[model samples]
Target: MLILAPMEGLLDHGLRTALTRVDGVDRCVSEFIRITDQLLPLRSFTRIVPELLRGSRTPSGVPVRPQLLGSDPACLADNAARLAELQPAGIDLNFGCPAKTVNRHRGGVVLMDEPELMQAIVAAVRRAVPAHIAVSAKMRLGIDDERRALECAQALEAGGASELAVHARTKAQGYRPPAYWESIATVRQGVRLPVIANGDIWTVEDALRCRAVTGCSALMLGRGLVRRPALARAIRWHDAGRPMADADVDPCVAALPWPQVLPLLAEFWQDVCGRVERRHRAGRLKQWLNHLRHAYPEAQQAFDALRASNEPEAIAAWLLQHQELAALAARAPEVEMTA
Candidate 1:
């Protein structure tokens, strides 16, 4: 299955709604809610995961699991229980985030350095929540080294993590290319539960390679999905039965006309603009355009022209008038038919 990665400050509900509407996204995790020293109010969890009150699902009907980020096992367990009371699809612990601010706060990848603490956190959370509710952990291979990857995975598993998602890089790698798929393989080998492969899976081919290298059956897509929304659908199609006959650009990426994807972006902007303060809406649109540019190279030009404008209407008009983007916007949903 393809899981959407919980990208802090990016994959907000609007983006999750839009992306999940695209085929092949099985489920997604919410932006990690940081827990420091106390229990958060119920409103806090509901606000971040509004879908929790909406069946814990995006409008498209895909589950959106709530993820917690904290250092103290007791605090984590307390929050996990509170989150469970809301009936989230599942609870995910954040250990793979490499943000320096988060690490400095004694959360995320920083905890990967302490397998015992990681184990304790997961165990506490597992014991706090009901037995039927699933508990999962996401972590990078290691902090400065990969030697302890196996230990970390084993610890989480022993602590009752139903599954482990490994961002295939050391804390030091910090989202760089050439994610160590080999390290993910090591973690999978050492654990009995599912070990998902993540990091640098920018294309369908990258996903295939990751699964092959790590012997992992599942993939956690992050920026790659943001760049190419059709990616998971493409990977599923290729993995189902077809031989991966192409080795050049991913067929899915090749099939999309950049100009055909603009309207979708515009629609997402429309939905998200009302959710945030007016001053912040433009930045959000630009943020998506930045990632979309990775796959739709033509977006680079449009973003350059409108990066300074905060008006959604002006940006949408500008995007629509440009043949490069307008054409992509006007293009049909080829991914649905072909994928």
Candidate 2:
């Protein structure tokens, strides 16, 4: 199963809708909703995961599980119960975030140091939500090292997490290379619940290697998917034993071509214009184009051209011109043949 990882600031509902529209993502976890001392208003949850209002599914129909982050067991349980009222696909607990601000507040990866507390938090949330709503958790290896990885996985399982997604890195190794897929194998062996491997899966080859090394069929994609929108589709093709081939690229890793990617970008920009504030709209588009640069040289050119401009109008004009160019290119061969 390919699940879209919940990136706090980057993967909001707009991007989620756009990415899931491309094929192969089975589900998605919403960016964590930080639970604190009290129960949050329902609007707060809906704002982060508008899918909640639409049956907890993206516009493309992929189910989205809402994730909650905090340190208090009872408070988390209370909020989980409240969130259950909205009927999400599932409830996910966040124990994997490595942000120092979150850790300083006794949330995120810091909880790994206290497996007992992590267990309690999961157990309480599991009990609070209805039996039908699945309760899952995502966690890193440990705060400083992998010493407590297995213990933490076992603790989450014992606390009633229906499944676990391990990010394959300790907090100290935040977003670095070499995601330690073998360590995921260790945790998978230690826990009875199904374990999903995460971290550093950038291409179809990486996905296959991660699955082979971790012995986990499931994967949660983050920056990888953001960089290559068709990554999940490519991975799915490979899994089905029918890989797609591109003349200029490796058959196993070739994703959506530049022309194909433009429409998706157009759709994303429309969504951003609808929801994001005017002042911040251009930055949002630039953020995605920056990631798209990894896969498409066109994206590099686009990014470089837009780097100095923050005006939404200028960006819109650029998109309009490129889209028109793509259209002309598509008709060029037919025009030449007729001549």
**Evaluated with lDDT, which candidate comes out highest?**
2
- The whole-model C-alpha lDDT of candidate 1 against the native structure comes to 0.85
Highest-scoring model, TM-score: 2
The candidate 1 region of ten consecutive residues with least summed lDDT is 323-332
User: TM-scores of the models, in the given order?
Assistant: 0.90, 0.97
RMSD after CA superposition, every candidate: 4.2, 1.4
Residues 171-193, candidate 1: write the lDDT tens digits: 88887788999988988988899
| Runs off by more than 4 Å, candidate 2 | 247-253, 336-339
What lDDT would each prediction earn against the true structure? Answer: 0.85, 0.92
lDDT tens digits by residue: candidate 2, 185-217? 999998899999999998888998999999999
Clashes of each: 6, 0
- Where model 1 places Cα greater than 4 Å from the true spot, the runs are 241-250, 254-256, 319-339
